[model samples]
Target: MAQSVHFSTPVDTVVSRMRALDTALPERDGLAVFNRVYLTVTEEFDRQLDAGLFPDRRAAISLDVRFAERYLTVAEDGRAPACWRPLLQFRRHPGVRPLQFALSGINAHIGHDLALALVDTCRTLGCEPADLEDEFDRVGDLLVSLEERVREELMPGPDLFQIADPLTHLLGSWSLERAREATWAAARALWALRGLPDLAEEFADRLDSAVGLAGRMLLTPLPI
Candidate 1:
């Protein structure tokens, strides 16, 4: 028999663990780490939904909303978590495709929030929003291209290994190698605005530490 797990506990534990790890990071880099962790958690939640681990799509989205709420609540108080409440309610509606769309919207919301946070962090170091926006756009383009490849080649056929190959070889490699690319860009933008030499380094260190912690959590076995 398969064992069932409560939705909130493991997710909360992971967030709490992440919080401890966040302490070692610089503030700017910490935000990037938080963004990565949020993305990873949301992606895993979606994967569970696809695998039928939840009773239905509704259940999956409900669980996701709960997880997101817990995550945001822990990270920045209850403010941002309130935004995800609508997503939870949307799950109760009928229709698989609409539910999927809503989930996509939720992901977009989270992404935008991260991007804006990056901009704000840069601004605090005296960087211009336009410069940060440019970097964000560049990163978004790269992500879109990678996503297209994953959708076209990896998801369409029975040869799962082939799809996994590129995702593993290309996207995975890029993510690992350039994990701090966003922080670098943010730092550079800040430098351009204020000539802050230490700002970028500080942010980069924090991001690296956070990512390391998140990687460990991902590898850890959950009770589920």
Candidate 2:
């Protein structure tokens, strides 16, 4: 019989692990911090999924919870509070569409992969093919919904240029510091997703490639 999955570790244990992970992240680079945060958050989400925390085998709720905890921790950490605030603000702001779109894409990718993994695991455990088909259909519906949400977020609006302009200006002011941070965050998110099974591994690989391109863009010299 397949063993029932459960979260054996206490909540405190997960929190401690997250704290340790945060402390180990690079402190001098804002881009590094962004990458680290996204990576860490995704890992926590996967941990929750592996532990069977969600009814639907999706990572959205877990991501929200992990993100909240991370934000609280950064706000309380005196030495890094200033640096974290802007990032947190960006997350909360609706005008920063690209960041939101990127996060939504990450979430959708992970959620879809997890659902597929769960279906495969269930089949291995002797689930009937019909039931497995049903589950797959459900997961497919969810993925469609997630994709639609991502599309809506990514769609350019009248303020699209306006929103991107400020970020571009900020990057120019800091010589791509913020852009570098965004790249780092993308890398970390991909790293965290790497822990999933084969499907997730593929998704992570794609994300890794995307991050690499983004990172190169960040490092490109801006015309003076």
Candidate 3:
């Protein structure tokens, strides 16, 4: 089962909950594939924290836990945002490859959930988005490196690398760089609109819808 455990707000507990999900899910399950990648990334983030990479350790911990909670919420209850719906909906489809699943989940988490997480962390820590920029950049750097590794490890080989290949275009169509840029912008906008709860929620809903469209494209069925 891909169902997750009871997760607490603490960082270690977050990691442990993800680990439990990883252990319970089947190896080839799409949810498991993404969960495994997320587990590795979260563990790496935890290590960097322990090593004191962030200048404001407290801020970093707050952001990390809040960011993780966005995904864990869905993992625990299937109460996913629009951006996450595509991956959850198509996860079991035979035509959706492992790499597709991985990327779709990444697209949803990075593009949509991240912005909300930033806002959430700021609210919890009584800080502004500007205050958390350094920690955000550090985590972004880690994500960039890990994304490259994920592509290398999960991407299909030369046999699937032709101009005519749908996967080629699909892979090229989305860029992590662009996504991060947009996420940061969204976070700032969200922060600015915090005073107007209605507008802020509308903005978030639109962002979620936009990211969901991208995720749906990423999960487009491929030939089995």
Q: Write model 2 residue lDDT over 36-134, tens digit each, in one string.
A: 434454455556456665564423333333333433444345222222333333343334444332433233223222333433444345443343343
Residues 1-224, model 1: lDDT tens digits: 98755454344455555555456445333233334444554455544544565553443343334434444553455243333333333323332122122223324333323433554444454545454444344334444554444335323246546534443333232242243345445444544545554875455445434443433222222111
Question: What TM-score does candidate 1 get on C-alpha atoms?
Answer: 0.30
TM values, all candidates: 0.30, 0.28, 0.92
Give lDDT tens digits, candidate 3, residues 103-197: 88888888998899999999988999999999888888888888889888887788776522777678789888899999999999999999999
What's the CA RMSD for each of the models?
A: 17.8, 13.1, 5.8
RMSD of 2: 13.1
Q: Which portions of model 3 miss their true places by more than 4 Å?
A: 1-9, 160-164
**TM-score pick, better of 2 and 3:** 3
